[model samples]
Target: MRGVWYRRSAGRVQAGAVLVLAGGLLAGCATAPPRNPNNLCSIFQEKRSWYHAAMRQEAKWHIPVSVPMAMMNQESSFRANARTRRTYILWIIPWGHISTAYGYAQAKDEIWHDYQRQTGAGGSRTDYADALNFMNWYITNSRKVDGIPVTDATRQYLAYHEGWTGYRRRTYASKGWLVTVARKVGHRAQQYQQQYDACKDRLKGGWWENFWDWLF
Candidate 1:
């Protein structure tokens, strides 16, 4: 009877441990990328929290919602745990990543640290809200430092990819590919703006409406 009781207790403990481990793994896993990334309205409809976060950032930073949203799509395609591709060793084995840029915005470690220090906000890069906030904050500062307008997604993306100093020095002129990519980002921003204008009314509401939606 004692041996049977001990075995039962041990089995229960093992099962509890397994459950805890599974919970931890689930917590650490990245959220799956949105299904329809091309359409800004579809993306927002699928992820309502993302719309709220983007609106909050836009309200706080005065950067247009379309600009950072387009840039983020180019950077990470809305993947929460996105990182730079790894470099290969001898064209076979995987080595270190191209840079320390990580999470939804592809923000580098040094620049991300600077953002935290300057803003006095604590947040994780893997979090969508934090990433959107960081991107808008960087764009707002870019406007201040580089004289680039908030709505000019092209120059804003150029300044974002190249540091402000690099942008000031016109380094993007040497990189034709980057220049093209920036133009693409700009085009996407325009598309997002058009789409958002059509559906923004539905997204906006008073606190009670928002609360009701949350409950449902």
Candidate 2:
């Protein structure tokens, strides 16, 4: 009888522990904004700092805010530590043969090396913010040669997708895949902007009213 009682108490303790852990997870999810809310396959979230930093970088460098955001969405969905070194997309089959790209940004060999030299940043090798910074520098330079405004996120985004040579050449055949990717990124960026606007509009009570009203 005592053994049965002790076993039941132990089981209760384990159940309680599980419940606490589950609750903590739920709470974290509730507070953290999702990277891909539509795709809940991964239990991942984006950081707030990157959003602010990317926005500031765009304005400061005369780049586009949507460009970075869109890239983040597609590249790693703003997941900072997005793994890029995984060679196995499938358990038995490896993804890369001769070359590989890693990080939230999915930078390849030359890009990884260049970014390391230029930025003095590394880790996860694929973080979206690092990727954003890299593209910010790249696009700014590419825009001048391509006769496109670096401040125009939409155009610059397209240019970044196409690379400097492709942008300058305007090689439609070479840019076919890039064009498709850019269109998808544009749509996703528009969606995200709309979401941001809606969220601002739905600010709870007078909490954000001061800031909003102060603006306009």
Candidate 3:
């Protein structure tokens, strides 16, 4: 009887381990970055849910889908687990990350908490939907707080990288590299806008097509 009990306990442990491994594999697959990060249409085609989420955000926030999507691409290349590079200690050993920015949006810890508190939404940065929604909310607020136009991806990204107060203080003018990066983000937004215009109707399929896609 003792031997039988021990065998059953070992079997249960092995089963639990297998279950944990399976869960990890599924999560890794789910968070894998898109194959074509440069092409907005291809990215959306590959991830229909992302297109839907972007459309939803646009509808709710009155911000164009291309703007935030472009900013996110610049931020993380759409990688779900992206984060700041680690610092080095004494120029040799590795230290903690330079900043607390992480996940698809690379949002800092403080701003992320502010988003959660203001929106009352519970979600992690690793989730594409949540990150996009957070971008929408923050960009909309930038327009309200800083008078930056929603269509001006350059200024909007400046405000995004620098807080509203920093934008008001014109701190970004001193950071030439940051200003160049913001211009690149703006160019990418224009590219995404053209691509989105061509494919949006297809993405928003007929009811039956939507149902079929949902079923599959």
Tell me which residue pairs clash in candidate 2. Answer: 84-102, 84-103, 103-126, 104-126, 104-127
lDDT of 2: 0.59
The lDDT-based order of candidates, best leading, equals: 3, 1, 2
Per-residue C-alpha lDDT of model 2 across residues 1-216, encoded as one tens digit per residue: 999999999999999999999999966654343646442122212443444455557666765555555665676654545545546765877776643555556556686677577768664344445667776666667666777665455556566655668666776456677677777776766665566555533422254644553354
Residue 76 alpha-carbon offset, candidate 1, angstroms: 0.8
What are the C-alpha RMSDs, in order, of all predicted structures?
4.0, 7.7, 3.9
**Quick one: best TM-score, which candidate?**
3
**Model 3 segments more than 4 A misplaced:** 1-26, 89-97, 206-209, 212-216
RMSD of candidate 3 to the truth, in angstroms, is: 3.9
- Return the number of clashes found in candidate 1: 0
Candidate 1, run of 10 with poorest lDDT: 25-34
Specify the highest-lDDT model's number: 3
Off by over 4 Å in 2: 1-46, 79-98, 116-124, 151-158, 171-177, 197-216
lDDT of 1 at 110: 98
Q: How much lDDT does candidate 1 score?
A: 0.89
Error of 1 at 70 (Å): 0.2
**Per-model TM against the reference:** 0.82, 0.56, 0.83
Question: What are the per-model numbers of colliding residue pairs?
Answer: 0, 5, 0
Residue-wise C-alpha lDDT for candidate 1, range 11-126, written one tens digit per residue: 99999999999988765543667788878888888777778778767878877799999999999988888877777879999886479999999999999999999999899999
